[model samples]
Target chain A: MIKFSDKQLAIPKLMRPVYLVTAGQSKFDRAFPDKRTEELCIDALTQAAEMINVTPAELKSYIHTCYYGHFADHFGDQLLGEAVIHDRLGLDPLGNCGVKTGGATGGTTLWEGVKAVASGYSNCVLSMGWERMDEVPTDEGNFLISCAADKDWESPLGHIYTGYYAVMAQKYWKVFGKEEDSFRRTLAEIAVKHHGYARMNPYAQSPMKITIEDVLNSPVVAYPLRALDCCLMSVGAACAIICDEATAIKLTKNSPHKPLRIWVTAGSHTLRPADRRDMAIPLLPNETADQYKDLGKKFPGGERYPGFTGFLAARMAAYYAYNQVGIKDPTADLDVIELHDAFTISDVQTYEDIGIRPYGYGRDYVESGDCYHMNPKTGKPGKLPSNLSGGLIGCMHSVGATGIMQVFEIACHIWNRWAEIHGDDKLWKKFDRKKPADWTDLQVKGAKRALAISHAGVGSHVTATILMDPDKLIKKDA
Target chain B: MSMFGQVHVKNGQYKIKGDFHELTPNMPIRNSDDGWKLMGVTNPRDMTYIHSYGGESIFFESLSKGKLMATRCDNKKCESKGSIYQPFRIFCPDCLSKMTVIDMTDIAKKTAKIHTFMVCERSGAFNILKRPIKFINIEFDGVCTILMSYLAVGEPEIGMRVVPIFQKLDPTYTILDMAWVPEKTKSNHLPKGFSF
Candidate 1:
C-alpha cells in the first residue's frame, strides 16, 4: 500500500496569473517527405504569430525564453534537435531548454512556460513541440517506442509497447467492462465519433467516415483492440505563446480575442504497470469515500486501486488541477474538453480518471451522447462535448506535438473560432484535402472554459491544462 | 571475416572484440507522384548495443538454473518491510536500502496464477517470439508485484494456474530465458530448450 502526506497532496500554486495569448499547429500527416522538420516548425510558429495579427518578427520581440518539446532523438537521429529548431526560428541567444516526457511533452512544455511567466522570470515565453516519426519504418518505430518500457524485463517480451499496454486493457475489459458485448460496442462508438469529427478538421491526418462495424471488422493488433481502436503515428508541429497578464494584453492588443487564463498541473506513476501497488482511490472533488467502498462487490476483481485499469498519473493531475482551479465538478463546471484518446479504451478510462464520469460507468459518457459536439439523440449541444479536435484517435499522435494540438483546438472553441479555423476553404486546399460538402460547424457557442489531458507511456507522466475566460472565474482568488 | 560483437569485463573495464557495426550505403528517395523528383536520402544504420545487467545480473543468471529469484525488503525501519518483489528490485522502493535476494522458485511453481493476459498478433522489428504471443502477468501468493512474462504453451485466461519454465539449454542470459506454462503441462508439450 502507498500513502501521501498532507504536504504532498497540497494544492499547487502559481506566483501570479498566467494567460495563453495564442496557439497554432501545422497540418498533420503520416509522413512529410518533401518538407524538413524545421519547415513544419516554422509553419506552426508562423500560424501562432498570425493568430495574434502580428508579424513573426513582432512576435519574437515579446518572447524572452523558449521551451521545446521533441520526444524521440533517435527517431530523428538528431541529439540537439531543439537547438536546431531554435536556430532556425532565429531566436538566437535566448535561453531555451528541451522538455520530453513521451507523449506528454507538449503539455509539460507549456507547464514550464507558464511557470517562467508566473515567477516573473520572463514576461512572455514560447512553448513549441514536434515529432519526426517518419524517419524510420513502422516496425522499427515500434521497437524504438518499446525501449520506453523497462529494457531488462518488459521490452523483450515481444519488443512491442502495445503488449505492455494491452495487458491493462485486457484487465479493464474484464473487470470494469465485465466482458459485456454492449461495452465492446461502446468502445467501437468512440472510434466512429472521433473519425467523424476528424472529417471536419482540415489539419487532421486520418479523416475516415468509419462505422462501428468497420471498427469491429478492422484487423486486430491485440485481441479486443483493433487497428481502428489505436491512435495514428504522425509527423507534425504545434506551439503556444504563454505570457504574464501585461504581456498577454500587449500581444493581443490589436487582435479580436482576449487572452485565456491558463493553468497546467502534472502527476506521474511507475513506468512499468507491474510496479503499481495497491492503494485507496484518490477521490476527485466530485467523489465521496463511500461511493467506492464496495467497488469490488460491485465489480469483482476491481478492488485494486489502479491495478491495470486506472491511470494514477491522470487522476493525480486532475486532482491537483481541479483543486488549484477550484473545479467542483468537471461535467457541470467545464464547457468542453480534449482528452488524450491514445486508444478507444484508454479514452473511456480517462473519463473515469479525470472524473468526467464515475468509475465503471465511463461508457455512459459516450452512450448518452454527452461526449459529442452535437448530441445525436437530441440534436442539442452536449452537456460537455469532448475531443472535438478528433483527439489522438483520428487526429495525430505526433508525440511532442499532440498535447499542444489539443490546447490549440480547445482554445479555438473558447475563442468561438472553431468553424473559422476548421472550415476554412483555403486551409483545406492548401493541405491538398477535399472539403466534404456536408461539413458541419462544430463550434460550442458561448464557450467560456475548457480542459485538455496530455498523457505519456502507460501512465508514467500526465498533465492537465485548464483554460478559462478571465471573467468566468470559479473562485475569485484562483 | 567479420564476426558478431563480443565483450567481457577485464580489469574493471570492458574488453571488446570482433565487429560491432556494419557499413551500409545511403539511397536516394524519389517521389513517384512528382516526376520522380529526389526528396531525401535514406541513411542506413546497423549497429549493436552493449548493455550491462549490473546488480540485477543474479536474477537473469538464476533463470538458466531453473530458479525464480525475487527480492525482499528486510529493513526493519521501512514501512514496507517484509514485502517480496517478483521483478527483483535491487533496493527497497520506500527505503533505499539494498534488498535481500530470495529464491522463490517453489512459491512461483505452487502459487503462480495469471492476473491478466493479452494475445498480441503483431510484433515490432527484430522480435524473436512466435507470432500471436500469449502475454501474461503472473502473480504469486506472497509477492507484492506481478511479473510480466509470456506463456510458452496453451491459451491464457485470467486466474489460470501457471508454472515457470526456464531455458536450461542454450540460455540467452536474458528475460527470454524464462517463460510460463499452464499448471500440469507435460514436459513434451514445452517449447524447445525450455524445461520446468
Candidate 2:
C-alpha cells in the first residue's frame, strides 16, 4: 500500500497521513421546516454509514472522537451541542470537542480532528456540521449573522454583510470589471453555471438554471448583487469520518467496492481577518503605488483600505496549502474544486484568491471558459469542474454544514462511482465561455487531486483542504 | 473563555440580576409644536450608546459644544512624532504610554478635508436618511486617525473644506449628533477650551 519508500518522501514533520474514510450529507433544501438540528445530524450520519457500507453501530464503534460545528445561537437552544450529540449517539465523549469559527466552523472541526489523529491522540474521528435556518425568518436570520461582524466598529455603523460584499464587488468592478455592466454578466455566468450544475445534483436546492438577463432583472438585494447573486439559505447537515493511514488502508482493503484511498494532505485557515493585521499594499489601484514609497513614515502599515479582508484571508490559506502540498500551479495541478460561492461575485474573487487566476481577471477567467461546469454533447469538463455538487449556490448553505459538504463532494469524485450515481440529464450550461478539456462529467475522469475551499463570514475566516487520490499521486510523484 | 468554561451556567442554574422595563425612545420625526403646527413621531430603531472609554466621554461632551478634540501620545518614544488621534487616544500605540489630550477646537474647523465617500442608496438602521445618505471619511489637519461621519449639507468633494454641524433637534447626542459639511456659518459655534 505504501507507494513511496521512507527515503523517497521528504515528508514534513508537521504533516501526516490523515485520510477521509467516508463523507455524507443530508440533501439540502430551501428550508427543512419540520427537521431539527439533531434530526439533521442523525440523518446525515445515517447516510454516511450507508455510504461507508457499514451499520450504525459498526461505524459508531470506529469513531474515536467527534467534533461538531454549528454557527448561530438563535437557530436553536443547544449551547452544549457536542455534548448533547454525544448523548444522543450513545457514544463515549472523552476526546470530543465543539468548534465554532464563524462559518469556518466545519473546516476547523475537520482540522481539529485531523490534528487529533495526526498527534496520535485518536485513530478515527468524526466531524459533524449542521444548521437549521428554517426556524426563523430571513430578516432575523440576517440580523443574527450580522452580529458576527466587528460589533464595536462595523456593526454599529449599520453595516450589513451583503452590503459589505456589495461594496467590495463594486470596487472590484471599478478596478477589474472596467465597462459598465460587464461585471454583472460575469456574476451571472457564475450563478448560471452553479445553478445548472446543481440541476444534476439531487442533493441541491437551486437546481434551476438562470440567465445573465434573469440575474440582471432580479431584485437588487444590494447594489450590483441581485437576489439570484446571493445563495439561498439552507437547512441541512453533513458529516465526514477521518482516520489514520493504517485504519484507512484496513477499511479500503476490506470493502467490496473499488479502492478509494483519499488522503487529507493539508488544511489551511485565516481566522481573524479584520483584526490588526499589516496591509502590505492597497487593493484598489486608485491609490498610486508610489504613494507607499515611504508610507510607514506616517501610516503604520501603509494606507488601511478596509475591503476584501476575507479574500486576502482566503488567499493566505491557499498560499499555505499550496506550500504544504508542494504545488506551484493550482490550475494544472488540482482536478476538482468546491469553493464557497455564497455570492456569484465571491466565486469570481475566489478564482483570484485560490491562485488559479490573477487579481482583476477573475471575471475574465470565467468569460474565457477556464472553469465552466460541463459541455453537454461531449460530456466533458468545459474548463475546470468547480462546484460539481452545485455548490452553496445550488446545494443550499446550512451555515456550518456548507464547508463540510464541500469536502463531502470532493470525496465523491475520488470514490469513482460519482458519475453513474448522479444521473446527468438536466444541467446548468446555459451560459458560455467554452474552454478546452476532454474529461467526462461527474467522474472527474483521470483526476489525481482535488480541493474543497470554504470562507466564513465575509472573509473573516477561510479554510482550504487539499485531498489527493493516493495511488495516482504517489505513482506520479514516484 | 475561562469565565465560560468556569461554570457560568451549568444545568441552567443562574441568578436573575434585574427586572425588565418598557422602552420608549426620543424619536427624530419632526414635531411642529403640535398644538401650533404638526405632530412629531420617532425612528423605531432609535438607539443610545454611552461611549465612556479612551477619552470618548469627554470627546462627546466637547463635540456637543462644537469642539474638535484630538489627543497626542506623550511617550517620548512614540513612533510617530506629534501624531494626532481623535475620539481621543488613551494610550500611545507605539510606546504604550498615556496620551496628552489636545483641543484643536478652531472656529475654523475648516481645516479638515474629505478623503473618500460613498452614498448609501439603501435604507438601514439610520432612518435619518430619507433619500440616499452621503457618508465620508474625513482627514482632519495634522490628525493621524481618519474620522468617519455623515455629510449634512451639500454634495461633498474630495479635499472639500468642511466643519461639524451639531444636531439642532436632539438635546442628548453623541459625536454623530453633529455632521461634517461645508463651513457656511460660525454663529452656532460654542468655544469650549483649547486643551483638556
How far off is residue A299 in model 1, in Å? 0.7
Task: Name the runs in model 1 displaced over 4 angstroms.
Answer: none
* Alpha-carbon RMSD of each model: 0.9, 11.3
Model 2 clash pairs are A196-A428, A310-A459, A369-A433, B27-B42
Query: Compared with the true structure, what per-residue lDDT tens digits does model 1 show for residues A2-93?
Result: 89899999998999999999998999999999899999999999999999899989999999999999999999889989999999999999
User: lDDT of candidate 2 vs native?
Assistant: 0.64
**For all the predictions, what are the DockQ values?**
0.81, 0.08
TM-score of chain B of each: 0.98, 0.63
lDDT of 2 by residue, A64-116 (tens): 88888888755654567767777777777556778777777777778777778
Each candidate's interface RMSD: 1.1, 7.7
Candidate 2 iRMSD in angstroms: 7.7
Which model scores highest in lDDT? 1
